[model samples]
Target: MAVQQNKKSRSKRDMRRSHDALTGPTLSVDATSGEKHRRHHVTADGFYRGKKVIDTGSNE
Candidate 1:
């Protein structure tokens, strides 16, 4: 078993854990569709920045 020879300082520990906190992805609502989607990402319907670029086939 490995043992710690020295204690980790508070500042060092905090800095290391700074990115450990869970955070929800930043999302923005589409003005046209009124749907919430992540920034810089296309909506489920394949729309990006208010433009329909992809053809999401209908699930008929």
Candidate 2:
């Protein structure tokens, strides 16, 4: 079994957890589709950075 050597102070504990806050995914707007998507990722219609990179074949 493991045990803490000393009681940690609230300030020290909170300082340790300062960077533990959750953050939402970073998003960028598509120049062509005018939609928001994750950075460096293709849009739903396969558009990336204003250019068609993949053929989603959703148009039927």
TM-score of each: 0.66, 0.86
**Maximum-TM-score candidate:** 2
> Residue-wise lDDT of candidate 2 within 1-60, one digit each (tens)?
999999999999999999999999999989887899999888998998789999998667
Worst-scoring 10-residue span by lDDT in model 2: 51-60
lDDT of 1 by residue, 1-60 (tens): 999999999999999999999988999998779999999999998889889988889766
Q: Model 1 — TM-score against the truth?
A: 0.66
